[model samples]
Target: MVVVRGALVLSLVALLLGLSAGPATAQGPKPTIVLVHGAFADSSGWRDVAANLRSEGYPVQTFDNPLRSPAYDSGQLEKQLATISGPIVLVGHSYGGFVITNTHDPDVRANVYIAAFAPASGEFVQGLLNPITYPGSRLLPPALQLKLVENDPTGIGGRNIDGYIARPYFRDIFAQDVSPAVAADMFAHQKSAALVANLEPSGAPSWATVPSWYLISTQDRVIPPALQRFMSSRAAPGRTAAVDASHASLVSRPADVTAIVLAAATAVQR
Candidate 1:
């Protein structure tokens, strides 16, 4: 009788302890961060941003955007996402925004756009700037200022071609706020984006369903600040921050970009 009573008491104690400890148990694994660079820039642009994220204890990955068609680039990114086991915070800059828009990966917990093109369904990067009749359209005559270095015939329908910013215009348009020396070096190494990548229409934007954040670069000459504001408002992102940096804010203002990315990462933790 005494043994039975003791067993019952012990069982009750164990149940109470389990219930009390439930909320204190470990949460699931942390989400990994995937940084996608925009056109003309390589993964090297994300070096500072990635470093900051890693310092914050985040598992970071930087994907080199092929600057190909939206569908093709997104498809490639989707493959990379498949390799990650935990949740992801997918971040895109400039043309990279269009790539992430097409990705409907289930593991993406949040989307972050850094002075990028957040096109809606049926809208392409060119279409966004094509309608701009005013002089404020920074990208209207991008080809004229960008020097053509290569004529790679590997793009979609052989229509897409690559071009880099001319040394003279590189500092003014792409990285206005960056030092002259750094801008020159960046211009020298800048990869030419396939022209078709900007012309192709975006599929259903993942931002439509997933939560989003935007880091608008007010001084951005590639994608104008007004356009960034318009797109960000249209998406109704969870958070929006504006910085005084240029289009290369990822490199010029890494801390600001890192903060917004970290916010998205922190939110997904809850």
Candidate 2:
């Protein structure tokens, strides 16, 4: 199933480049693509991108972020980062960008931000929520809030979220790159509540030190493309690439996202 999708997406990418899907077998490095999903979603959301990346010969590992507290997820990520023997490229989406940036190990060869939040020192991920009014934050049902509170003390994290409220209110953080079907799937698979409390800012911002790349989803509904650009600028990545997709650009336009990740990885290799 994914092979067909990969072939199609890759072909489209080739066409965009004014080239055919030539016989050229692009050999990518062996380093793994460690994917960290954002709030309201789990690792499965990365399945589509992972499959396409594998087709390009890149090893990928999508983590099931506890979605509990940022600190806890960081611990989990640290444990995973310990197991990989080769160099690694850390990728994050939305709030997951905070997770990747905050929990980064000195060993990470590169970092990739896909319309994700990359906060700096002493900045909490939830601090960005300041723009959201208290009543607005309460847009989530109380029942849902309780569920998220259970998984993450900060009232964040869970995949069981679904309903009309999500569609009209929550769907746009991602750009128009993703199809309705894919957006629906992501909403269904989103983690309930990711703890924003006790979520400290990045200890060692990867953008400041690591070879980093940023993929901006111009049409993102959630994080606002403007905010993404501001954050990327602060991080000072090696390069920045723009895509006309949603927040879930990795899923909606995996080829472009993959290219950005590959570029980051290639720089690390150099």
Candidate 3:
């Protein structure tokens, strides 16, 4: 009787172990969707899109972009990426695209660009804008009305520390399609990006190796729709879409942005 009882106990342990491991093997791991915001905007810009993704049962994470420079920002993001296990679908907005381009975490399965700066290897944001001469191009046309803040503590020969869009032009330039009330609020809380960040060259572009999706904002005045199209063409073939929204499309058109993100997440699952 003792021998029979011991054998049964061992079998029960094995059964329990098998059951514990069953789900992981049968369904695999789910990919986490990470949303990154760009210059002049905080993580709050992704609030709507994040909510949409969460409603669909996707684990969503929104990172606060340093907006200091691509290398520094990407380094911070890399540390965050290390904490997440399984696959990742990285989505970037505006200057966040440059940050994502510099990050090549192996767990990243796909990259999504939303009215964002998609720089090639060694290409800086300013360099991309040098050739664009569109009528409503915010970067040019009497130059961006920026309030430059100095970084020097002693206040002697201090270089420009950061650049904030002048409140008066923020709505017309960045969020023309958004409502006046929301645009006013957005302008009020907007953050300043280090002026040097735009001139900093990018490292190897992750989109070159990872699958990518681009959502060009047709009415984008900041990056310009023409520039968006040119960048989208260099991405993985046939992985592009467009929306007739302003530069803040992620905020103004959250549903469309969420749909594209979900498509990337689905692709990663397969």
Candidate 4:
């Protein structure tokens, strides 16, 4: 009887210890952060942001997002997310937002939108920039340069027109806050997004079911600040922040972007 009682007491003591421990005891390791870049840009644009996340001990991975259709890009991302066994924080910039939003990854702890598109079901990227719908956007036909993709190497259907920011207006529309030297470099490395990518109807947004956070760029010209406010509010995100930045907030304001992403990480960490 004494032996049994002692065993029960020990079990009780262990239970008490666990109950007294902080949230960290129940929390898993730091989540892997996956950043997806949108149209007209590539993964290299996330170097500074990824570096900041890495410094905080996060396992950071940046996607070389195919400027293909949203569903296709989401499928591409799924292949990478499959390798991660733990929690994940998905961060998207610009067109990258549509890609992340289309994901249904169960391990995604949070979706963070950095001056990105958080579109609704059946919404097209091009429609969002219509001044009649959400004014102040400089993404009209005049600001874009459409070129034919001869072979459609990314499998976005052959001979599709790819939309690129016009050379003269690239800096002003995309990264107004970035230095001229850096902006010029960014422009030179631009990736033209397939026209179908903008025209394709986005799948159901993960934001509808998953927790989300948004960092609105007040000085954004690519996506109007007002539209950012509307979309973030529509998502009913758990957290939202604003920065005095252009459309390339993730590049120009890496620290701010990192902070918001960190907030999402910390929330799920507990």
Instruction: Please report the candidate that would top TM-score against the real structure.
Output: 4
Give the best candidate by lDDT: 4
lDDT of each: 0.77, 0.66, 0.78, 0.82
- Structural similarity to truth (TM-score) of each candidate: 0.84, 0.76, 0.83, 0.88
Regions of model 2 farther than 4 Å from truth? 1-29, 129-177, 195-199
Candidate 4: worst 10 consecutive residues by lDDT?
A: 1-10
Off-target runs (Cα >4 Å) in candidate 3 are: 1-28, 131-136, 140-160
How do the residues 88-130 of candidate 1 rate in per-residue lDDT, one tens digit apiece?
Answer: 9999999989999899899999899999988899998777875
- Give residue 210's error in model 1 in angstroms: 0.9
Order of candidates by lDDT, top first?
4, 3, 1, 2
Q: How many backbone clashes does candidate 1 have?
A: 0
Of models 2 and 4, which has the larger TM-score? 4
After aligning candidate 3 to the native by TM-score, how far in Å is the CA of 28 from where it should be? 4.5
Residues 1-270, model 4: lDDT tens digits: 001122233233224323222232226678999999999999878888888777667899988888889988999999999999899999999999999999889999999999999999999888887788789988767788888878876654556788899888999999999999989989988999988898899888899998888989999988999989888997744367788999998788887777777666656677
